[model samples]
Target chain A: MAETRQTELAHADSRESVTPLGPVRRSRDLRVYLVVLGGVMMLADLSFIFWVAPTDSILGDIQRVFYFHVPIAVMSFLAFFVVFVASIVYLVTRSPAWDRLAQASAEVGVVFVTLALITGVIWARPIWGVWWTWEPRLTTTLILWLIYVAYLMVRAYAANPNQGARYSAVVGIVGFVDVPIVYYSVIWWRSIHPSPVVGPLAQANALEGTMAAVLLFSFITFLILFVFLVAQRMALRETEDRLGGIKSAMRRRAESVF
Target chain B: MVLVWKDILLEVRSRELVISVLVFGLLVAVVFNFALDVTPQRVTAIAPGILWVAFAFAATMAMSRAFVREREQGGLEGLLLSPVSRDAIFLGKALTNLLFMLLVEMVLLPVFAVLFGFSAMSFTLIGTIVLATLGFSLVGTLFSAIAAQTRSREIMLPVLFFPVILPVIIGAVEASTRAIGGETTVGLGRWLPLLAVFDALFLVICPWVFSFVVEE
Candidate 1:
């Protein structure tokens, strides 16, 4: 009975937060505009990355990967930061919406982190002469990926949805807190080994004028895309939860009538 | 303290957890000994890594059981209903885990000493063990509580535990290397204090999260 009431309350809460009841056309939704805007900017961003940005005199066009790599790295951090904050708020407020926000951010963050890792490897294979090395930054980002993946697993194996949210909130908070410590410890451990001659990240500060402008534009483009993806994900989760609530309510009513 | 005592009495009655974990640690040492080519010339370099790996394996196995009894026997709700705050419960379990872990480590230290021919009872090595184990149990106990409620409870602990405690492994191995290497001048430098910081931060954070964990 208590759960039935809570589901009713969730029904009310989600109804206000979601779109109006009906088949909404794609063009009429706000996300369509975001998708359109993000797509146009991303097209420009990719063109600048490939053609507009001056190739490096020494490294040649292989250096162009940095345009996407750096911004994707930055956006992953932003996404996880949102997860951390949303998690704390969800725990304190006991609100499912905040947990949904955290779930959305973590899903997006995992994708961005994977992209960043792949691009870093593409840049490293030429520069460092290896596909991967346990560089402090790369290792830290990899662990961050593991930590959030574990966060998702905790939710997946949890006994119920509310328990999943509560438990994953705990994991989210601790995992974000672990990131800096992991970086520092890895840096300390790497200190005894001879440092690499150069990394893609090291050249970031020395970009030429057109290159810097193109990099700056890529950052904004990725930011819009990140926002658009997360907004889209959060909306999808809200709809899933509402539909789940409706299905359970209908099952309960049918049992009563029978 | 009463809560800690209760855990102590339970473990003392059975002698199940620490003994099994002790054999597990020693077996890890034996496996690593055969797994790696631990030449006499390379003992100094590889010994600390071996020692800490054994300890970490022991920890994850032991920690997954931290709340099994309370949960399985349905004592957690009763314990929570008593006058103690949830923080007390968290600290109690964390402290119990630390004590059990230290006991296992101390026993295996002699084995490590015989296997690697390094004096494991040195002050610096023991101090490193304490600080690293402090951080380990602090994070481990919290994850244990969360994991105990999951469907795949035992399989879930290390998945949640290891990434968070990687810093402790890094710190402990480095500091233990300095201590065992006989680097008297640079012995255990900033690594020990760094582990202390890891412990201090989690000391305040884990318990606060525990309150929300048991809220309903």
Candidate 2:
């Protein structure tokens, strides 16, 4: 009974250290509201896509993927930007909260990027007649995917959590710096030798009223979804970190007892 | 300056760093020579690509040694303990990596010229190699330092290095193509500047990050 109570106190202490200082009760309510808002918004956004928004005259129904695809791409970039900023903060502050935030954002960013790539390929097959191309946007997105995947790998392979946080923070910054250059290099390459096959008319033709509205709405909806996912990931990461701490602390105590 | 000299002097004595990199670079060239089956007709067109692939991979090996050797010898902590700033240490290691890569290039360029029938003496091509190598060295040094502290480092270095350093590769290959094909310097202008820009950008960025990787 004494040991069990001690373990419980230890657990509570670790949890308090890891827990964010906001109204803890309100956060649960906030999470619940976020899910409900996100679900309803996502459903409305889908309806706006399939039924309300007019299809492209040139590309037709397959172009509907644009609504979700573009926003996810934007969110992935947003996620990574959070990572970049959070990483800088983590380095400066050495705070586990910021590290968890950076890690969570990176993971969500990677997943969003994967979704964007899949939707891109799905759209590309019928429109571009290939599963993939070296289009500037797509190419840079691919590079973005690789860099963060490497970031995740570093985190996984690290010798310890503190080391993982430090190394990945470095990678997070470097990877962001690389993304724009990758885009520029691809753009320059394409400019030098114009690809023979003409690309989709999406860039050349601007979206009209309803199409624009739907795209904007979906982007907002996805942003909410992205924030929700990241918050959940961060909470889980904090719990895992707290548990690791308690385990090690218990181990040290056990060693002392012997 | 002393850091560079220390590394170079050590490299000259053991001769292992440059020699191993040279062998690996030569092997990449030779293997690609077979792999691409570079017929005379196809050689010039593909020459830039092959040369760069060799250079990049070879430099990766050199970069891997930059810190890994120091680490294994237990000299890294001593270097860290020295009074020099972290940036200086990074610059010294990067400069050493740059020189090692250039040495390999000086040897490999002639071989590439012979095999692919391009004149190695083209100033434009030589300029591209120098500029591109600058970018590669800066980024590679920092990554090598980062990877040195990790597991499966050889693999980690490339995974982290390649995607980031790709612009240099593209710019180098494009510029080299124009140079080796005997094209005018006008064609060389864009790609070289792109490389210079990348070098300048990362020159500031890499050393800053190196501080983080080595921070105790």
Candidate 3:
């Protein structure tokens, strides 16, 4: 299975050499587009959040953090969802690429989750008067973060690459499935986190017009950033794999010479 | 059934796994006693948490030991070489782990009651124990198999086990606290169903995943 994949990857690599404007150029173009689009959207989101959106009658300026905070939280979920799907595929096919993708998405998801937790704490300080609360959403997010952290540790500490991929894929899928249960348990157990502000049951015009638009804009921006980071991370993993192959080849050659 | 009996009989003969786990569980309860200054009034309030924590840790110890004998003695290969389906192997190992955990719980519960100065041996509490143990052993056994094959099995099992089983711990702790507090129907009503849901879900999922894991 691995040999076939390596040969297929090598074939694709050779094909990239033959056509100057093939997948390589297209991927490069996509990367550029993602970066540019994400940056522009972020700037627009910042402006709308800081200057355009009406200040909350209750939370004042601090509520602006929700624009970025909620979106980062959403994007983190998206990243982990990708990891979950990729992990299932990897388990079924035993393909190295899917494992790489799962690892990349999980790493990126952890970063975004960290940012979400930090922003959440910052937002909570003036509003809730505490830097931390055992509220449902925050607690669930913390557990989610821990779950992925464990996922990454499994990948890092496995006995071999094959073992790592196989084990971590299982962890990834299991961890993702556990997320909803964690959320449900926390919510049912106790809930102090703010209820949804923009959903159907939200207060009358709680997030009207500019606030909703800014939130939407921020979500799109973070989505783009998520894609860009996962792509960069996956490419780095591929390079590492290629370098590992070369190092093993050199060791084999040295042993043959001896 | 044969495989399950084989594991149980083997455990009964050696007696090492249950002895160590029971002792460890007692020590945990004792440590918790010294660690927390429990007022008489608060004993019932905090007893459930302490008991469940002890059980959770002891279960980890037992689960980590689940496949060690098999892996070391090449008994797992012998089992695999049999005509038994992979699901049977998983069921057998899970049942053995469950039994080991329950044996420790049997001793741990009475010790916990005496040490903490409370007794709530209601059927609801017993039912909760069974359900929680089922959930723990179900997933814990599978992770034990996967971790036993790794470079650092001891550290890997808890790292994988705890995070995955967080819901179980939460559900069990809540339900047991209620059951012990004497709110029989209401207490069990909320948390017991959670345990049932988790156990049922993992009951179907873990064995399927175990087959894939042990195949390699």
Runs in model 3 lying further than 4 Å from the true structure: A1-26, A191-205
How large is the interface RMSD of each prediction? 0.6, 0.8, 1.3
Instruction: Please give the ranking of all candidate structures by lDDT, highest first, separated by commas.
Output: 2, 1, 3
> Which 10 successive residues of model 2 chain A have the least lDDT summed?
A16-25
DockQ computed for model 2 against the true two-chain complex using alpha carbons: 0.85
Q: Kindly list the per-residue Cα lDDT of model 2 for residues B10-41, writing each as its tens digit.
A: 98999987888878878888888889898888
* Residues B114-134, model 1: lDDT tens digits: 987887767888999999999
lDDT of 2 at B26: 80
Worst 10 residues of 3 chain B by lDDT: B181-190
Off by more than 4 A, model 2: A1-8, A11-16, A20-26, A200-204
**Position B148, candidate 3: lDDT:** 88
Best by DockQ: 1
Show the lowest summed lDDT stretch of 10 residues, model 2 chain B.
B180-189
What is candidate 3's local distance difference test score? 0.82
DockQ measured for candidate 3: 0.66
Model 1 chain B poorest ten-residue lDDT run: B181-190
Candidate 1 local lDDT, A1-258, one digit each (tens): 899767766665555434444423452386788899999999999998898898898788899988999999999999999999999999888777799889989989999999999999998899778999888898999999999999999999998888999999999999999999999988877876657655445587678999999999999999989988888887787778767766676666568769
A-chain TM-score per prediction?
0.89, 0.92, 0.84
The lDDT per prediction is: 0.88, 0.88, 0.82
